[model samples]
Target: MPDPTFAGRTVVVTGAGTGIGRATALAFAGQGATTVVVCGRRKERLEEVAAEHPAIVPVVADVATATGARALADEVRARGEGLDVLVHNAGVFRFSPLAALAPDTVREVLDTNLLGPLLVTGELLPALLARRGNIVLVSSRAGHNPGPGSSVYAASKAGVHSLTRSWAAELAVHGVRVNAVAPGYVRTEAYRANGMTDRQVEGLFDAVAGSVPLGRVADTDDITPWITRLADPAASLVTGQVITVDGGMDTGAGQTDQDA
Candidate 1:
């Protein structure tokens, strides 16, 4: 049987060139979305994703910039297809202490992870309202859990959680639900852009895997199902929530006394 939850809907996924974003676009397409607009800064990567599914349409744009964000909205509106599901997944992460990060780097993180969502949502609000659609913000466990050398990234995600609740409250009357999906340490190419060497990234993943009760890091697929479910009509009553898919790492399921 076909899962036609979005058979005729239009879904937009930012940072869809790779990792969670790529997986998410594929999920919506698999669910039968008419058009899954996959946005990212890399044309080649976005094209690759589009090649995997006919429903996926690649649009290279930097959601972090207001101009880029508006351009994307224009493209979507030009198609005359109302937006049904908007997923804010374009984020940048640099694992460094506040002092070590350049002023511009901090701004980059905040712009992409925080302001980008706001800009895109504001641009697409009318379409979302028209369809009574939902928004899914891709946040991180760092929003609640503050590990060392990640203050900027964590703060950006914490802001995402705040936006989830704020937008949910503001859009409820209009029938547009807002929520977030906070993923744990997932093994993705995202780390490759995080300024970590191959060996260091592998070592970090190894250490974090031990803390998870499930005894492993997450893959992109591990986080995709919740995203699709949240946007589906089956979860109509679910809003203003942050669903943490972290393999029980944040739940302390396997933490001993000293670890706690």
Candidate 2:
């Protein structure tokens, strides 16, 4: 049976173009969220996901600029007076070693990955506050332990992690809960999006799959449930927590296959 935990709530998911954002939007709809606004950089991608469910609403809004953030906030305001949940999943993770990083690329990464959440959340704070809502940030396990050639991306996500903790403490007084989901080694377009060729992507996947305790890369399915549950009333007392969904990745290595 489908969960009805979100029967009357409205959810806004940014970066709904492809993987996790797309999956999370659909999951909430399945769980009976009354409205699921799927905002992304691409009109067609968002529409494609929206077509799958009546509750999913598509809106093209870039999270890389204040103008984009304001537009999304306005869109939400037009639909209702309050927003029950806000998912900041919009981010850019183009990889570049420091020497290869261009000024513009750095700006784009910082703007989208770090500033976007702050701008979007600030614009929608009143609406969220009105409902005593929740905010779920999609950070990266790399934020805590950055991988090679991903310094900027890792730093940006680290900023997000810091925001998750700080905002939780700050928003607690107003009854708005803030939490983060830090996903590790998920097999998604992100590798290709990071400018890796298919061969490189496959190679990375093979390597990551080998290192993870579960011995496989994660699908979007592995990550969305924690997101939905965090926003649900069942986790009402949970806030300021960063749930790492990484197939036992964050746990340091020691156990062999036989130990499992």
Candidate 3:
């Protein structure tokens, strides 16, 4: 299944140090992308990803800040290749009730999850237009299904969904498609960093699996293909769509675990 559609194309994947971002970088490389820039704050993690694939060129940048996003775009421009695909996958997840949430924390979450993508995409618009590239934004299920202790995170992702639509409409004439993939409860380090013990994490997954129509949670690999597909040239007519890949968590459209 080696697709040469992206053989000589340049792709940039933000937040590609680990989790879904890392998976996506590898997926694009595997599909024949020549230059895959992995941008993130952690140089060490990016280095590890580079070790896994030679096509992965690690660029340490914090997408949450305007300066960092611009710097990353400049780095891509320095490479002298027009951007073929830009995947906004860098994100932060923090859970706190609205009462206990600090103003600074709220700003940080929104800046990282919402504004960062917008800034980076805006900076790279010229390059994308030159190549008629598309954009793939990594959103979350919380954006649509906001529950307890997820106010800030949910709000940020909801903004992302709106941006997806706005950018899609604006970029259509330029031949750039914009779309998002909203995932629910994928197994990633973010959960551990959010103060959940391994046991607690497992229990949470089991509970969610029991509640969701699907019997299990998702892995990073489970999500990479769909995101890559949207960026693929084959999906030329697809735009302004938020594809939900939550193992039927958002919609109870699958058979429940009890049914199994």
Question: What lDDT would candidate 2 get against the real structure?
Answer: 0.87
Q: Which candidate should be chosen as best, given TM-score against the real structure?
A: 1
Error of 1 at 144 (Å): 1.0
lDDT of 1: 0.89
- Model 3 Cα lDDT, one tens digit per residue, 2-120: 87868999999999998999999999999899999999998999999999888899988999888999889998899989999999999988877878999988988899999899889
Candidate 2 vs candidate 3: the lDDT winner is: 3
Candidate 2's residue-wise lDDT over 86-154, tens digit each? Answer: 999987777677789898888988999899999999999999999999999999987886776778888
RMSD value for candidate 3: 3.1
TM-score per prediction, in order, is 0.95, 0.95, 0.95
Give the per-residue lDDT digits (tens) of candidate 1, residues 1-260.
Answer: 98889999999999999999999999999999999988999999999999999999998889988888887898789988889999999998887775688898889999999999999998999989989999999999889876778888899999999999999999999999998999888878878886778898788778777778999889999999999999998899999999999889787674421110
Model 1 alpha-carbon drift over 4 Å, by segment:
254-260
TM-score attained by model 1: 0.95
The numbered model that scores best in lDDT is 1
lDDT of 1 at 216: 85
Better of 1 and 2 by lDDT: 1
